[model samples]
Target chain A: MNERILELFEETPETYVSGAEISRRLGVSRTAIWKHIEELRAEGYTFEAASRKGYRLISKPAKWQVSKLLNGMKTKALGQKVHIYDEVDSTQTIAHKLVASGAPEGTIVLAERQTAGRGRMGRSWHSPSGKGIWLSLILTPRIPVYFMPQLTLLSAVALCRAIQKVCQVDIGIKWPNDLLIHGKKVSGILLESSGEDERLKYVIAGVGISVNLLEEDYPEELRSIATSLAIESGGKVSREELVQAFLLEFEEMYALYMEKGFAPIRLLWEALSVTLKRPIRTSTPSGFIEGIADSLDDTGALTVITPNGERVKIYSGDIELK
Target chain B: MNERILELFEETPETYVSGAEISRRLGVSRTAIWKHIEELRAEGYTFEAASRKGYRLISKPAKWQVSKLLNGMKTKALGQKVHIYDEVDSTQTIAHKLVASGAPEGTIVLAERQTAGRGRMGRSWHSPSGKGIWLSLILTPRIPVYFMPQLTLLSAVALCRAIQKVCQVDIGIKWPNDLLIHGKKVSGILLESSGEDERLKYVIAGVGISVNLLEEDYPEELRSIATSLAIESGGKVSREELVQAFLLEFEEMYALYMEKGFAPIRLLWEALSVTLKRPIRTSTPSGFIEGIADSLDDTGALTVITPNGERVKIYSGDIELK
Candidate 1:
């Protein structure tokens, strides 16, 4: 397998391994081993080969390589098929295009930096090169499209866990998909879908995290609202490590979601929610309503207790924390 | 005002009145009449003016001409601004692009036919030239994006009312956005949105109607599952008349939605629902449940009484009519 070939090259650095040895180790033909080595070389691996010295792995790019990203991903399908874009306008837009073209479930779109990054409520997210994790994950969940709200909540929990494990900082979820540190936004999530009445073809979760940007890197307007991991952690954090942690956490939560339903996730989300049990003003199309946040129902709708004590379930909207 | 200018042209079809006469009739100066006539000419209208001869309405395209389409449409902001596309891949895609570019509310995209028409669940709809209505309406409703289900239901009611008034044939809303006549699909609606937590920037509702397609016009494979107005009424239907009727009905329903709430529309929808009080198979991502359709809850979820007599609320999924 090419995975084994990669492992062999990783094990021996600057030392050539013979084709016969690789074929013996992996029980494949010399031609096959040479073919795999050629493929690895095409994927930015510098392999030196000779009749006596088999293959020597020279160098690997410091960038986020697809092979390295998927090397440790633990899932049946999530993130297995990925598209790496050097630059893109919006990952969410690309994900929708992929879904329309019958891209497999769990196909991910990762960009070095988005030329036109978007945030919650059509706001622009500043995604500088190599500063944050700007990626969109495509999910083809068998769940009804209406239950899509849970995906955002689940993502918040996963992100929180990732940050806590990596930096050991106490972060909180701001109602929907905002990640807050001392009441400032460090990350945001946007969930989108395309489906019909009964069947959902795909859902794209566009995640933008302010991982390593300095205070100067942020726009002058967002200086007060946006914070990054380096600013909070006081040191540069490894983006690969954070992405790995986030992916692992997401897979775990997604599995639990399928097994136990949104009740357990709702419980976890409520524990981390900064808006639950707080008074908030939600502006709907017709008018605005001030209500206290109750709890999430089984379907992932946020139930709000109005001034009259009537519980009006808010399905999807922006909540202004009072 | 162009509205007054159009009125004069309508009242006197054979003669072109001088700018002075039009100004006197509309109580405006000659310059204002000239400006209004220029605007009308820009909208594909031809004007011939001599010393006494007025403007004549020469020709109007029967399919989705902006002037003719908005002639009878009523709304504060919806459908007031029209964009007619002679051919497009999909109107929804174009609408999304327009929304990103700051297109205003009530902007409409009407196409004579789609080169690659799309339907719900990633299916293709047959859009024969000049035989169907392929249109999308861009709305920036001030509602939580999750309550979009209610909008779909509202549009369904509007569509059914239009059909009833135009064709004198009974049509029913099939649980979601499908318009069914005698258990076959006649029209479908696909609603997509672009927004973030609680605030939707824009929502595009792509509607497909099999207007004047004959039985042979339909692909042989779709003959069993799809029907057209010609097949249903045994006579050719007017595309302009149907479009006008739909816009009027939709505007009225949208107004009622703003005045009252979704309760009244839900009541009307329940009355026309063929799935209610019937044994059916409801399939969700979790599993499949065979049950009797009881009613729809406030959040637009279908309450199904499972075979075990347990009421399970299905927020989204496919339902099979038994």
Candidate 2:
């Protein structure tokens, strides 16, 4: 009933609905309508009540509003089943638990804040309360486990397209994980999987996008290196709209990749990449290698040409532009 | 105290120890020792007692004897922390649970019977009570996920070597997983892993070996397709000795793999393979392909020369000799 009322308010954002009309349409008493309004108010929804105008929705809470998120969702599988949290240790941890308990593909876990957010290679991600999109998407791709790195690249392209659509900012993807705006990190993706020898059981693609966070939200060490969409756009970005856009974009790209292959996704990733054709240094498990960032191989590995004219394929590494 | 008693009896299989000697060595009363012996007898251990010679171990239960298994375990890590079950759904399932709860690498879960054992690609495995070695070994190898298939090959080689050393029967590895004796499968390997995009978190290598199972032990449908070490060797094979040998051999091979990479393990696997240089038909996800098995690529993928003279890499498939 509350969701229905919220949907009614969302349908017309600038108008007032009379209590008598709401009661008649909803087949409820005036007192019941008033009680629901009070409940909404308690949940941080603001309304303006006047003797003649009845009630008008003024503003929604800064926290996630599921009704608003689901209002204009266009994705088929992605975000169809959503689990929202106010605060969590990490959305990825919750998603792992959900996947273990047989959560279907495209089931999403979102949090308003993460006390222990993580990035690729077990690094920390800064996620302030109600200021970023911290989410983990459960995916069960039928592709072989060797092709899993392509999914990370696919996610980066999806997020870049979604951010471009939502915030109108030109975002570039750093090889493997980070999404950047003017060389400052705006988002990061961490992809984890559990599976058999050849096929994957499920993958938890954890994406943390800084949306509404200000400069002060980042820690002192991360202030210069990290950025948010609102900071880059010079305005407060709507987290709900960004999430909806991302889901739609990711769903479309995922379907494309599943139908076509990594070729299309590789093209999109290369177009949005800030790491290609540059001198870079990578700290890989095999040790450090300094080379020119060349191109992606078929399995999504970055092929780098060393000073000695040797071509090396880097599977996973911490790369920095030189 | 029971394990100590078992160790004392195992020290001199041909001799017997009086109750007075056991009481003195274990610092327990004769009544306490007698109570423990009653407990052991209730657990299917047979004893022979004489007027002067107190007790001799006549036979142990067909079930796994954890005390005997640990008595001469030579490996440093493998099977160091063992969990034994008389019956389980699957050792792989229990191993997954254990890994999720922070069980260390090389921890093992063994069961006398699996009510719902699984093979590769969701196939069912027949595991009757006390007739086979059904176990799952938890491994935390510091390797990329792509190299996980090599672990399966390495396990097959280890099982082949172990079975040869213990049972002295010639065993051959069928391309990806199966261990065959005279063209019939004697064992199968199923390797499952949980990990990040590039690095593996842990691997559960489940091994099922038909050790002491006779012709009547298999189901009607499986009798023609499966053989046991006992059936091949015309005698009852010691399940404990075979398991110990496997643990030792696998531990050594796993260490070698971690240190020297997959080249040596690949050579060993190829030497034991019955699939190479044979006309074969493989049912892969891409569809059916008939070819002659050529060799293993560097990453352990099976390379096959098709009838059209195209060399295709088979990452995973069900193959049969054409």
Candidate 3:
């Protein structure tokens, strides 16, 4: 009933739909329609009210609603089921719950804001309200547990292709997974899994894309290290199109990964990577490793060679480089 | 308070401890002491009572108490903190919760029986009450997530050594982590991880050993493929002793694996392995591979030299060998 009311308003955007028309079409009371409007308003939807004119839909927040998000999506399996929230601690938190309840693969959880968004290695991700793509994709991939971490690298390539197609912006990828634009971080991926042995119960991939947040929106410490597509382009961007493009790209990449293995995806990732062959310094568990970022090993580890010609395959670390 | 109640019974095993003396030692009423004893009894504890003499400590079921498991554990980290349950759905389930709640590394969750004990690749593990060692160890290793699965193999060797010392039975370790005795599986290991990117949040290693289960304890189907220590040794075995020895072995092996890479553990595992240098057939996702088992890779994957002279790395599989 709520989605029907939303559809009536969304079908004729920026136009007023009378309470009588909505009630007649949806077989609900005018008071029911009013209650629906109030609920949508609580979820960040705005409507202009007039005494005689029922209600004019000033805007529709379908990006924060599953019904509208999947109302006309053409992807075969991706985003077929959508979980939406106006606000959340993190999309991944809700995704875990949904996955445990047997949500199918390709199910997505999208949040308008994340109160405690997460990044790699317990780092805090800056997720502002109603800005950026704060989404987590719940997947149940039938693969060995040892190769599960490779999904992080596969998702980066997929997201990179999506950003290019939707936003028409070329980006450089850091080895392993973070996305960079002009040497500043534009996106980060966090993958968490629940499984026993070789089979995964569920894999939740949390992706935070800095889409429209301005320079000042980031904290003082993050100002120099983080960026958004809108700030770089000096224009507002459509997050909906970007999201649709991402699901399509990710579905394709995931299909290819399952079919042909990571070899082909590795090629595409290496092509878009800028961290290769660059001077780098990484803080590993043992100590600090300073060397030239050489290549990505088969397991998606960043292989760095020091000045003394000793090679190191670093699986995880904080990287610093120009 | 619960641990204190358990202490008197454990302190003088098979000896009578007067109720009045117990009340005076713990500063509780005689009725409170009786209540605690009843609570313990409800959790599968059996006590012998007489009119003149107080409760005589007859036997102990370790799953009802955690303090007994850690009372004299010598490991610096492993098994220092133990969570005991009379009957759990699964120890890994509780271990995951504990790890999420900031349970330190080497925290152990031991259960008398699991209603739904999980085995490798989602198979059902037969865990009879008070008959087997059903435990999950929580580890917070500082290594990369890709190398984390090797701990399962490291654990297999540790358990093998512990079993050799406890039961005096010569066992053969399958390529990856299963412990086989007389060509039947005696134990299985399941490794689960919660992490993002390259760093692991925590690794939960669930180990289930069929220790004292009788021949009739196993189902008809499991009788051929699975055997208990009691079934093989023709006598009842103590699970508490096996657990303590295994934790000590694991602590040593884990310390060595971290200090020196997987090389030392790999060598030890190779010495006890029966699945190496043999003609083997395995069903992988790609297809079936018939090969001669060559060696173990650095990541503890079985390196199989196929008939076509290609070395295929089998990460996880069901192996039939001659």
Go through the candidates in order and give each one's DockQ: 0.19, 0.44, 0.41
In candidate 3 the C-alpha lDDT for residue A196 amounts to: 58
Winner by DockQ: 2
> How much DockQ does model 3 earn?
0.41
What lDDT does candidate 2 reach at residue A187?
92
What is candidate 2's CA lDDT for residue B138? 95
Residue ranges of candidate 1 with Cα displaced over 4 Å: A1-68, A84-90, A93-102, A195-199, A215-224, A277-294, A301-322, B1-68, B74-76, B85-102, B195-199, B219-225, B286-288
Taking chain A of candidate 2, what TM-score results?
A: 0.80
**Model 1 in CAPRI terms: which quality?**
incorrect
**Which lDDT tens digits does candidate 3 get at residues A111-161?**
887889988878788776666889999888877667776788899998999
Which digits, one per residue and each the tens of the lDDT, describe model 1 over residues A61-137? 23566666778677677777888886689988899889879888778888877878887766788877667788888
- Model 2 lDDT, full chain set: 0.86
For each prediction in turn, the share of the native Cα contacts (below 8 Å between chains A and B) that it retains comes to 0.31, 0.55, 0.62
lDDT of 3 by residue, B234-282 (tens): 7778777788899999999998998998999989999999999999999
Tens digits of lDDT, candidate 2, B1-322:
8889999999889688999999998999989988998767544465676878798886665877778899868889998999999989999999999998999998999998788999988899988777789999999987777777788789899999999999889889998879999999999999998878677888999999988776655556888899999899999887878888999999999989888999999999999999999999987766898999999998788999999999999887678987
* Winning model by TM-score: 3
Docking class of 3: acceptable
Angstrom error at residue A274, model 1 = 3.2
Point out the worst 10-residue segment of candidate 3 chain A by lDDT: A59-68
lDDT of each: 0.76, 0.86, 0.82
